[model samples]
Target: MREYLADISRETEVWTADVPTHMIHFNGDRFLGPHS
Candidate 1:
């Protein structure tokens, strides 16, 4: 999946968690990064 994402766009951000689950956020009007 990482390779595919990278191929799409270099600006794409890829993050992986210790668990099997993951999340992604695209350009939006609001903040998409992790929050407190």
Candidate 2:
């Protein structure tokens, strides 16, 4: 869980422009895949 959250935080930092709203969703979708 910590690793996942850390990765998410790192990804969010890299894509700070559209953080929570856009990039987070895209990142989650990309990492977790369609089924998740």
Candidate 3:
């Protein structure tokens, strides 16, 4: 069910790099802003 999938997603550990310190510079000069 959707609730079960949601629970699994919530409990999962997703690995990602920490937000870079210069991301603001990159955002201004490169990519768009972060999204929801």
Candidate 4:
């Protein structure tokens, strides 16, 4: 996977979830969600 992701910046923002919830994101600006 390193070869495939090597082009992306190391300073890239990351968001991860193992469970499910409602996520509302606007453009590439911000994320609005209950986030619980």
> Which candidate gets the maximum lDDT versus the true structure?
1
lDDT of 1: 0.51
lDDT of 4 by residue, 1-36 (tens): 334356556666545454445332223334544444
lDDT of 1 by residue, 1-36 (tens): 554564556655554456546545444323555665
Clashes of each: 0, 0, 0, 0
Cα lDDT tens digits, model 2, 1-36, are 333465564445332333444433435445556764
TM-score of each: 0.26, 0.19, 0.22, 0.28
**Residue by residue across 1-36, what tens digits does model 3's lDDT show?**
323344444434433236643222212322334654
Candidate 2 lDDT score relative to the true structure: 0.44
Model 3: how far residue 25 lies from native, Å? 25
Model 4 has an lDDT value of: 0.43
- TM-score of predicted structure 4: 0.28
Find the 10 residues in a row with the least total lDDT in model 4: 22-31
Model 2, 1: alpha-carbon shift in Å?
A: 16
Model 1 Cα displacement at 18 (Å)?
1.1
In candidate 3, which residue ranges exceed 4 Å CA deviation? 1-8, 19-36
> Of models 2 and 4, which has the larger lDDT?
2
